[model samples]
Target: MQEATETTHSTAPQLAAPAAESSVRRTVLLAFVIILVALLGVFASRFSVSPRGAASPALLVATQPALAITAALAAMIVSLLIALTLAKPINAVVSLFALGCAFAAYAMQTGTISDFVFLGANFKLAALETIAWSVFIALAAIITFRVGGPLVDVPAHNRDGTFTGEIIHKRALMSLLAAVLAIPVLIFTMIGASKGQAIGACAIAGVLTSVIGRMIAPRAQPILLFAMPALVIGLAQLALAFATTISPDIAFVNATLSPIRVPMPMDIATGSLIGVAIGLGWSKGLVKHEPPSMHDE
Candidate 1:
């Protein structure tokens, strides 16, 4: 009976792996469905004025009742899914969402005497702006989980005297890490897609950089940790641009490199901000584990 009990205890984790995978799979599926519905709803809304009968195209394009509403709802939904996965509350996610939106609005806001408000002239673009701006904020929140720190279930020295951070199987650790990383990307991708943007690649790259950086140099300085990936990306873009100038590959450049727009300050800023956030979050996590951190099951 003692032998049987010992065997069961050893095999418990192996059995739990399948259950955890199933839960993750379900969460991903649910998030996907929500995103699809959100996109369909946005397009279905009749916020854009019909171009055929409009007296002024600009005025027509500027008026957007549906888009604003859709964006708010989408933001909330996206934020909630992310929050749930990260083991954070709705309030935290909401704060991040608001910050992102504010940043976008500030960047887009004009200093013109007539139009001092951000995106004031083109309110119709609010949704796209929110989605784009929030990409970094969302990515930062996700990074806080992967290499950020451990979310311990109990104190280091429990009554039983078992340390929570005891070494586990390599496969189990990898699986946990993968699930923790994937959840944010999944939600971020869905949000980006809903807004007709491609910020998914940026998030993926940012997370990977954070993970690899931690493994290679766990004690690296926060600033360097954050800035290195962005620098590498910038250099890569520079190389690509040089290559394009020497080769007659306009088609390839336009198709693949156009969207990345490495020459643009905005793109560089976005990437760098994401990296900094990731590094900062990782450093914080390394310092200590606390409540509200993304729970990696």
Candidate 2:
């Protein structure tokens, strides 16, 4: 018995070594995936907006709307594939945010919002393009959740595929409130002249938005609420930009049309993803309840 116990103790460290090594490898792989996804997203965004080597945002959007839509769709498909086959939902979401971060970084380096600026009829086209991309990406994500539910270990709330009237109403109300509150908070936090400041602002906005969301709807999924601040800020910026075209003479309109301060998709993506994971109490808030698998049953 003593010899058996000694043998078991001696093998424990050997067994643990492989587990630790596997963990490190996973961490490394996740990091690589984040970087790769971010780069790909940036590449896709650049390709979409500047298909013909156009320098002007208005010209690019005006001429290449189809290409823009296609590029955005492709990027989202790639993201969905990654999520379904390689990464957890959380990791996949973080990768999406990394893509947003890449956008923010590029914008910062450019030192101007001119790349994103659109005017007249092109403004409408640009808006349509944005909406198309958003809708496509959202649908892709939904499909991933639905199809890969069991494989990805989707939360019970998401996998259930049923929402009562009361739940819908409550979620909608909370979402509206979060969007309204997020605007000012995002604007204020995003007020800075440097890239680090801009990134920091996004982080702050994400954390605050997550906190606010949790306060208002404690039972709601954190992932659902994470993008609220970014969406609100993006819409506000779009509105302000459109208003500038309507009233080009208005100093306030022109002054307020700073896309540099507006959180890029990735910025909000990264910030909100992390904020939700960390701020909402990861074990409880992120996972909630998982339904049993067929094997378990």
Clashing pairs in 1: 109-118
For 1-297, candidate 1 gives per-residue lDDT tens digits of: 999999999999999999899778756654554454334333333333323322111212334645634543454345334433433321222222222232222222212111211222332232233234334443544443333233332222222322223223232233223213322343334332111132334445445555544443332222223333334444444444455433223333333323332112222223334434443355444543333222322
* Predicted candidate 2 versus true structure: per-residue lDDT over 9-40, tens digit per residue: 99999999998997887667666655665565
- The model with the greatest TM-score is 2
C-alpha lDDT (0 to 100) for residue 100 of candidate 2:
44
Q: Which parts of model 1 are misplaced by more than 4 Å? A: 1-78, 81-204, 212-259, 262-297
Error of 1 at 100 (Å): 13
TM-score of each: 0.32, 0.63
In order of listing, the candidates' clash counts read 1, 2
